[model samples]
Target: MALVNTKEMFKKAYEGGYAIGAFNVNNMEIIQGITEAAGELKAPVILQVSKGARAYANPTYLVKLVEAAVAQNPDIPITLHLDHGPSYEMCKACIDDGFTSVMFDGSSKPFEENVAEAAKVVEYAHKYNVTVEAELGTLGGVEDEVSVEADKAMYTDPEQVQDFVNQTGVDSLAIAIGTSHGAYKFKPGQDPKLRLDILEEVSKRLPGFPIVLHGASSVPQEFVNIINQYGGNMPNAIGIPESELRKAAKMAVCKINVDSDIRLAMTASIRKYFAEHPDHFDPRQYLAPARQAVKDMVAHKITEVMGCDGKA
Candidate 1:
């Protein structure tokens, strides 16, 4: 099977009460890990590229890598998406470059400007049969090229959701429900809660329309402990609880963004490998185990959290 757009996938997920995992891809191992796990579980997946990831790994290489994954796993559905595209031009460029889905992240812009730019990108993307995702509110924390201070982050105003959707015609709406970017989503002893009231209101207004959640990774404590024990410092790193995400999946949220968890898993494995074997200088010697760790993490998320393990 070839790469697919999210239109049909989102429709199915909306009716099925589950959300597809949108994992950010950086290199070959990360892509391999995510796709392998999703394929094994027969789950539909989205391999998304962030601006930083595009800068790190060339855009063409990432797109071809996703194509290769599709060739390897012909049964599971996969969508290549641009995560948080900053400008109309960037979104258009990705659409032209064969991304089946693109996100125009104008959340930080003025409301009217954001709607106008998103609408522009939507118009362009629709012409190419590419789905567009637009963010309604800013999510805080640093990951890739997306960074917003906590003071600047705001919960998506439920009142504006309908207008935003009607004006932009975005294929999916990413709303800020208290989840932030990166592993440190919440501070120690702070309650990590999603604004389900806001989610409820958005669902009431948008009914069957697909919704998206950014910064949805539940950072596994095992990885954090392993990294810290093996000469790494990721102190007080936290993430959304899996239970909350499961509830969100049952709502209109048909797509969930995850990146930091994969990073944590790979980093922990590599750290442990290096600490145990000081003589292994070859990249494969360490990267192989790191890739396996990522695969395991993704499999766990699909089966336990997202509940899309066999929905492919």
Candidate 2:
């Protein structure tokens, strides 16, 4: 159909032991790639726009591009979401502009202020039947305008989950359970393990409430190698393992955020294309393959990691 909020989608995903893939969109190719993959797999998808994305590609352009994608794939469910919304005004602006869902990312603020601002946005968004996702704990690493230090990152306190939910009335809760933002989530030698114990505790406190995982991209080694081989120097770009993400999908987690993987795939494809076809000067000639690479990555995530394929 058209763009929809994550309320029903998350409910079904939670009951069915799957998580909806929330892919970030920065341009027309990225939007096309994500929706094409989701439509082909018959999976529900969320196309999220970050503040940086809105600045790079104007909000109207992004909205219309998503609308065009929906028109192209009428059978698949797609939602336009505001990722890491920093303030109530930002969330409100997106809602008024027809975003189906919005996240009030107040994780870096004081807990009381976070809750208060989230509550205010929730109050306004609910009136329009839009879904609101609120972050409880700060996730480390940087993505666009959102940034946090590793030392400052904290796993969401399971004890405060119920109170936060009760106070904010948010549809979903994004928790930092050891997953950092950006492609370099962990070092080369370090382990990448999600805090499932914290997830379990949160689930126990608010059973069936939709849980969200940010910075969940499993950076494919293939893309990393391709980029490096094609004259890029991205050293030790590690991400959460696919097995760990699959486990989270089987738990209370109903939404998984992925951005860096798509970027890596697209960049690697373009770099390889340019290296091989040095004569090609047209943007579409190379961007087409890059878009296809993104589609492939997202399809893999939906089928293998999130377990959301054919769940539309």
Candidate 3:
């Protein structure tokens, strides 16, 4: 099958009470790892690229890498998405570059400006049969170029969701329900709880509308432990609990963004490989295990957390 837009995938996920994993990708190994896992599980997936990824890998290389993954896994559906697209031009560029979906994250802009920008992108994207995702509230923490301080982060107001969706004509909406970016999502003493009430209210407002959750990676403790045990010093890193993420997936959320988990998994595996094989200098010697670690992490998320396994 050809690369698909997220419209059909999100529709099925929403109806089936499962969410598709939107894993961030920057290179060939990450793309292979994520798509291979999804293909084996017969699960649909969203391979997302951030601005940072585009800058690091170049847009052409990233797009071709995703194309290669699609060729390798023709049985499974894959959507190439732009995560947290900072501007209308960026979103349009992705749409023109063959991305099936693009997110215009105008969360930092004023309400009216955000609506205008998102509406503009949606109009252009729809002309090419591409899907657009828009965000209503800001998420705290840093991912790529997106960074919001904890105090500045705000929850999506349920009252505004209907208007936002109606005005922007977005195919999906990403609402802030207390999940933040990066691994250190919460302070050590703070309670890491998602405001499911907000999600419920948003669902009621926009019935059957596909919803998205950003910064939803449940930083698996095993990967963290491995990184630390292998001589890394990441202290007090925390993430949203898998149980809570499962609850969201069962609700209105149709897509969940997870990037940090893959990073941790790859980092941990490479660190461990280096510790054990000190004499091995070839890049593949370490990167091979790192790739497998990504595959395992993605598989676990598909089967255990997102509950989208076999949904393709």
The candidate that wins on lDDT is 2
Candidates in order have lDDT scores of 0.92, 0.94, 0.93
What are the per-residue Cα lDDT tens digits for candidate 1 across 226-279?
A: 998988788876789989999999998899988999999999999999999999
Per-residue error for 18 in candidate 3, Å, reads 0.4
Which residue pairs in candidate 1 collide? Answer: none
**Candidate 1: how many backbone clashes?**
0
> Which segments of candidate 2 are over 4 A away from where they belong?
none
Q: Model 2 residue 300 lDDT?
A: 91
Error of 3 at 285 (Å): 1.1
lDDT of 3 by residue, 174-276 (tens): 9999999999887567778989999999999999999999998877778878889989888766789889999999999999999999999999999999999
Q: Against the correct fold, how does model 3 do in TM-score? A: 0.98
Residues 1-312, model 2: lDDT tens digits: 888999999999999999999999999999999999999999999999999999999999999999999999999889999999999999999999999999999998888999999999999999999999999888999899988888989989999999999999999999988888898888788888989999999999999999999999888888889999989998876799889989999999999999999999999999999999999999999999999998999999999999999988
Model 1 global lDDT (CA atoms, 0 to 1): 0.92
- Which candidate order results from sorting by lDDT in descending order? 2, 3, 1
